[model samples]
Target: MSKISKLFKGSSSSSSSSSRSKHRSRGGPTPQEAIHRLRETEEMLTKKQDYLEKKIEQEIMVAKKHGTKNKRAALQALKRKKRLEAQLTQIDGTLSTIEFQREALENSHTNTEVLNNLSFATKAMKKVHENMDLDKIDDMMQDITEQQDVAQEISEAISRPFGETFDEDELLAELAELEQEDLEESMKSMGGLPSVPSSKLPSAWHGHRTTTKKRVEEEDDMHMLASWAT
Candidate 1:
């Protein structure tokens, strides 16, 4: 009887330990409760997934509206625009410098042409003046040569004798008397000379006076010779 009581106590302790182990193995909940907890966890995870997807979609939409799909792409485009702007500014500066240099070159060319034309004109004028001076000098030399020839001819005529036996002084006086008579006749035929002498006359004529007496005497001598011969 003692041995059977000990065996029953041992079996009761073993059964209690087994029941506690079985309860602990089920995680202190029923199968239906576990299923409900799993469903709740699944629902929360689904809602979080949906919220994240919607937020991602909204971000994509915002990016599309702003014209870029990503931050890096947008930054690259901005940098490209800045570079293009800098290039355009540099090109404009180069063009401005070229235009200014072209204008200056044109002005310099124009000034050079003007200076060349002015120098040519000045040279031409100087040549013309020199030619005119040479022409005037030639005219003066010709006039002097003509006057010398006339003077030589007059001197030769004055030294020649009128007849074979006449002295030079008597021949010259007779030629002078005849020239005076002929000049008076010519003046009378041309309606006579002015009472006042010409300003251009030689100074030797200023004191001279003449008459037609020698002409009348020579004419009477010629008539007497003609009568005697008849």
Candidate 2:
């Protein structure tokens, strides 16, 4: 009997869980529905407040009309007015609270929408940045620069002057031969030039040297005459 009871309890618990899961699958009321409900409540509370206010005003008029004419009637009317006033005050408080609740709900709903938009924007930005990498960008730029340099070098090579080519040693040999021929030509030209006579010294220079030699000879003769006189 105990085992059968345990089995029944397990079956019941399983069914309850399945039912709960089914209930969970059914969606709850949305914020719009909740806000609508709040508005309905606010409307009801406002109507109640209006009714209480009207009733309080009617009791006041009755009390004023019966004033001093029927003291007991006036007193009873005033009492009724006070009770209506209290009810109106309570309704007013209820309406204020309802309005506050509705405003809070609206703010919450707006915040939810704003948060969703921000989340979407964040996801979009993340996706945009996903395909970008600093390292890859740097490598790509380097490859581009290298390609540009190679293109420039190729362009420069293609734009070279189309002139004769010469081997270095051959060019040097040719240059030496040309220089030798130039020297030979210069020597031939010099050979054809007028020659200076070996004895073509200036007359003043020759006179100066001859005058010096004669003065030395005269001095030697004077020395010989002095020796004879002695």
Candidate 3:
């Protein structure tokens, strides 16, 4: 309304702003500090309450001591005790309110921290899932399944039996019959052969002829053993 008042108001506002900045620079009380302050106040109130209780007890003793002897003194002591009791009641209420405030502040601080952590975790999960596409994953899995089926079919084809089946007994019977025919043909061919006369041959030729006959006999024995093994 006046220049002086306006100047005073502006100065006052500047001072308040400076004070707030100073407080901020000093790092104003956190929830923990506030809770600590409340606890200290609560403790102080409890101590005061105890002092009042003790005072009330002393006044009661004084009232009892003076009750029969001095009525006036006894009335004064009773009045003091009543006043002390009132103070104690007031302290109790104050302590209750401080404790409630401290507890609420602590709960709010804890909830704030929990919400911040949850928010951080949610952002991290969002970033992680940003690279993923469910449709691409599904398509890749389907392709893998098809490839596995194709591989299974190829494996089956590779392991399949390739030829017609024949009985072991029938094969053995046929081999024995072929051996019998060979034996009969050999016996007939030997029977029609002319025997060598060693007396008319040269000594070296006879020796060679004897060795050839022995070798032929050994070959026949080996062939017979092979047929038996088969």
Candidate 4:
């Protein structure tokens, strides 16, 4: 570009910069500084109000002291007390206004900070999700759901019965019945009692029976001796 144009641009830029600085300076104090100033003013006003109250009380006492003995002095003292009370009232109003302003400033500062944080969070979220979109998310979820369904089907297939099934309870019941039959048969066989012979027998029969018993005993002895020898 031409030298004249460049010089003009430079001057314009400097003027603009100065204007911005001036505007910034004229924009007044920050929220915190303003709030601090307001609070200080409130405290000063409060102290002044207290002083005025005390002065008013003193003036009342002076007026009471003059009572009717000195009506003009009493009137003057009462007037001074009224003026002090007015001053105190004005201070009270001023302090209220300053407190309200401080509170408003604090709230505004808090809102601004909250907005800044939200904006930062929004930017970060956008940066993190820059390459992501709803379509991809939906597709991913669909794939996950499909995989889960396949897994569920696989699990079900694995758990399905592959062989013939029978009622084990019925088999156990039949086995129990067989065991009961065997038990009953064993008990029946064991329940038999040998018949007992009558102690009194005819002489002839007894002599015969004794002979037979002797013969059987002799055979048993021979068999036992044979077994021992072998």
Candidate 5:
């Protein structure tokens, strides 16, 4: 190539190399992404391995079929079988590596998720407690208790009878005084009874009998009233 052409080619190659390097240096795939890719690779490798196994079997059968009848043919078939087996073994190793990598990535993903959840919970708890303290909580509880006590007192007051209060002993004493006054008024209203005459006259006798009957009736009335009062 000419010098200019060579220089242009070098520049292109350098540019391509730098781009590849940058791609390689970019942030790695997430665990989920890497595991997905590993699983896909494992599946592809498994299919290849299966194909190789079938090929190996076919080669073995070919070798057997040519066994003594054609030594050269049998040798070629055997050689092909050996190559197929080697490829299969390599594929198996690759599968094992892929499986291990996938498992490691899964474990790492689970651990990361758990850590994130724990961090979230911690932040939530901190936010909830930001404006609170033990002293404030205690004060709130005390206030609640005081309010409850006040409510209880109000309830008790509401439940009581709505009426004027009176002393039982004082009421009894007043009633006794009223009964005494009634008895004295009854005795005074009767006034002095007519004096009994020593000498008997028909008129005097009639008057004495009438007075006695009236006094008896008054006594019976007083007894009945006293009984009613009691």
Candidate 6:
């Protein structure tokens, strides 16, 4: 019993000493130190908050100035930007997946591996056709130029015959002479009208016959008178 009491007394003393030591080690800070630490923390937090606020204000001002023309447009642009950012993230993920696939393929040693690949042959053909079309356009332009030159030459040739004036009187005289010649040729081909001739012979023949008959009758009367006188 006495040993147990001694042990309890020792434990109590040690605990009391440890408590007093802990109490003595704890000291009060100066007002200035406390205030300075608080002030420093506050200032740092304030500066951080201020910088964030300024950045937000600047972003707002920039958005107001040039982000969009109107509130609705600005909202739409923000939404669209968010959608684009999401699409970009998705594209990045897809590109990362493609890179990983490519790395895996490169690491593999199989010669008969199948892969999805894009062929640029069509695009190259399209470019070639575009260049060809451009060349054709140039050729068409040259052809047009040549045609214009030919047209100009033809125009010059046509204009070379007549200097500035035309002879109106000479043309009119030539037309009149042609018309007169045509008229004279037509009249000569159509001949003139014919005429008849006259004759006189029947009346004289009948009168001579009557005279002979009368002479014959007178001769007969003279013969009868000579016979009576004889």
Q: What value of lDDT does candidate 2 attain over all alpha carbons?
A: 0.77
Residues 1-230 of candidate 3: C-alpha lDDT, one tens digit per residue? 95535654765686568657756887676777677767766776776676778889999999999987899999999999889888888888888889889999999999999999999999999999999999999999999999999999999999999999999999999999987777666656656334767467888988898899889877875765575457
- What is residue 3's positional error in candidate 3, in angstroms? 49
Worst 10 residues of 5 by lDDT: 2-11
Q: Candidate 6's residue-wise lDDT over 1-230, tens digit each?
A: 65435654765686567556655786643334334433443444344444445545554565566654676766655565555456545545655555555455444523323221123566677788875677789899999999999999999998886557769999899988876665555445545222222554377765775586678556644554454346
Q: After superposition, how far is residue 139 of candidate 1 from its true place, in Å?
A: 10
Q: For candidate 2, lDDT tens digit of each residue in 115-227? A: 99999999999999999999999999999999999999999999997988878999899988876676556546545333435785689987886787678656754654454
Each model's number of backbone clashes?
Answer: 0, 0, 0, 0, 0, 0
Give RMSD to native, each candidate: 40.3, 22.0, 15.6, 16.5, 13.5, 37.6
For residues 1-230, write the lDDT of model 5, one tens digit per residue. 95435654765686567556655887555676667667766766776776778888899999999999999999999999988888788888888888888898899899999999999999999999998999989999999999999999999999999889999999999999997777667655767344656766688878888788789868866775776568
Query: Model 1 off-target regions past 4 Å?
Result: 1-68, 134-230
* Model 6 segments more than 4 A misplaced: 1-62, 66-69, 110-230
Question: What stretches of model 2 exceed 4 Å from their correct place?
Answer: 1-27, 147-230
Candidate 4 per-residue C-alpha lDDT over 147-186 given as tens digits, one digit per residue, 9 for 90 to 100: 9999999999999999889899999999888766765554
lDDT of 1: 0.60
- What shift in Å separates residue 198 of candidate 4 from its native position after superposition? 43
The local distance difference test score of each candidate is 0.60, 0.77, 0.81, 0.78, 0.80, 0.56
Once fitted onto the true fold, the runs of candidate 5 whose alpha carbons sit more than 4 angstroms away are 1-25, 162-230
Better of 2 and 5 by TM-score: 5
Indicate which candidate wins on lDDT: 3
Model 5 sits at a Cα RMSD from the real structure of 13.5
Local error of candidate 4 at residue 130 (angstroms): 1.6
Task: State every prediction's TM-score relative to the real structure.
Answer: 0.30, 0.51, 0.58, 0.53, 0.57, 0.20
Worst 10 residues of 3 by lDDT: 185-194
